[model samples]
Target: MPIAFTVTYAVFAFILGSVIGSFLNVVILRTPEKMSIVTEPSHCFSCGHRLAWYDMFPIFSYIFLRGRCRYCGEKFSPRYMVVELITAVIYCLSYLVFAVFQPADWWKIAFSAVMFPVLIVLSMIDIDRFEIPYWCSAVMAVLGIAAIFVFPSEIVWYERLIAMGVILVLFAVLVLIGGMGGGDMQLMIGASLLLGYRVFAGLLIGILFGAIYGSIKKLRDSKAEKQLTEQIRDIAEQWYKNQLDRGVGYVADERSDVIVGSISDGAPDIEWEFLDEKVWVGLPDKSELSRMLRQNITDEREGGFKIFISGADVKKVKYSRRMVFGPFLAVGIAVSWFVGAQIVDWYTNLF
Candidate 1:
């Protein structure tokens, strides 16, 4: 291809990506809140002033506006500009890698075009909500299915199936062990089909990044976690006393475990089934206690609390909340799309 044509295509790709990124901003903001992405005009969240066309030109608009609403002058998040820039850059890279460099693998351009946007949306949403949308994973799975027919020579269909199955089982164990979530598992299951054996490389990269972030996050959150533990201990002590006074339940001699379930917007997500009926005189309404606990805990991330007891003494209280893996996994997936084959080959050569 001529240099002129290549540059033109790359420029077009960047423009297209920025436009898509602009739309994705709506998706990331609305999807978690169950708001409609379509039929909703772009408006300032602070003032509800509808944005004009000139105000919504992706990266340029944000730069020109100084990252503030025209109507309210309220500061907008830098994320809007950042997402658009990243998407635009990724789009150009995909075209260069798949279309310009390896023209024979042109189909990969389509794969990356759709896959990267979904990854971006899911990553941002996971960061904000601590959950990955099922639809995002489903879209990847559909892409994986389509890739089987479009690029059969790249990887055998059965290999894709095998990789997906293996990932499903492996991630299931990880989820049970509390090392990962079902959303991460589902995302990888679809990714395995698309990348075949290369999905393992993606997973490895994702885990490596997640582990590093987890370590740093753990250190940073240690103070908050300690404060939360103390709060939980106090709550548990009072609740235990109340239960004992009401003749409802008492911590069994051998089994002294306190479990708090997932807390959400409305109801406390605790699983009452886990509590042993044998040790309880009667189950008490947990709503009041749950409400109180919710007031004390203020983090938006999804998590649970565990309390250990030893003969009427609160031994320890642990709060477990892991950083979102979707973003890290997404980074891995994007990298694998670019260089997974080389990575796989290098690892095999070591043997």
Candidate 2:
């Protein structure tokens, strides 16, 4: 419990965290692309310059190189530095708060330290790709199961099981209602098994943050759409005019001007992955529509031919974009891991 010992362990934690953060950057970049994380050497995305040893020293390298590739001079995103710094600081804080305070409590600190990278990877991957890797959730669930055997938790065994069941059912309902994603549900189930009733605090915290963020995002997207819709509409209008000149006229109340033969309007639109299941042969652009219109001119006797695109496809392009929830849930999970017991204790005391 000496001050000197605490400082030394904190420093060690920071170094360890920085190293892990460096590896996590690679995972975040490659995992979504299905690229080999270990075999592939780190290279500049723009210039394809393989990073030298000196250029790969986590936060320091980014700083010394002025956040640019050493060879190509292409500036790197500040995210690299932020990730390293956040990880280092969190690790240091974990050591000082949980480990150093009680020399015998290294296990708790170790668990928290290990979870940092997992949460970071999940958050970043979710940001990049809307899907959360099932493996991450499985790892979390496995850790929870291990904790049940290895550590003595205050929450009873049945409570953990019940919590897991409740969360799964509740989140399944939310997913059906479009309030949550399938990935978020999986994560919550894992978290519930790990944290028991205290997982509710995590859900509350996550939903609190998510709702605030969702509001901001909704407003931002709405404003951007207002500006962007005008521009895209101008293009669409020009495209429609071109189609009209090619003997394709407007329908009575059609959603889109350009249509393809294979796609259907009546079928279920969004697949479970939240992607429109269509191989985009070409855009519904002016030139493409004109070509298609001319090609489909076999029915010239039936007045001006009109191509009616599926409303779903039109909405996917102009109106729909999936919202991300994994990052918020990950944040909640991290918070719950750190202080869920404390939160429960404080709440009980309040009563």
- Compose the digit string of candidate 2's lDDT tens values, residues 117-159: 8878888877766768888888788777766765655577788
Number of the top TM-score candidate:
1
TM-score of predicted structure 2: 0.75
Off by over 4 Å in 1: 265-269, 278-281, 298-301
Estimate candidate 1's RMSD in Å.
2.0
Clashing pairs in 2: none
Model 1 per-residue lDDT tens digits across residues 139-194: 99999899799879888999999999999889988898786888998899889989
| Candidate 2 runs further than 4 Å off | 225-320
Taking all chains together, each candidate's TM-score versus the true structure is 0.94, 0.75
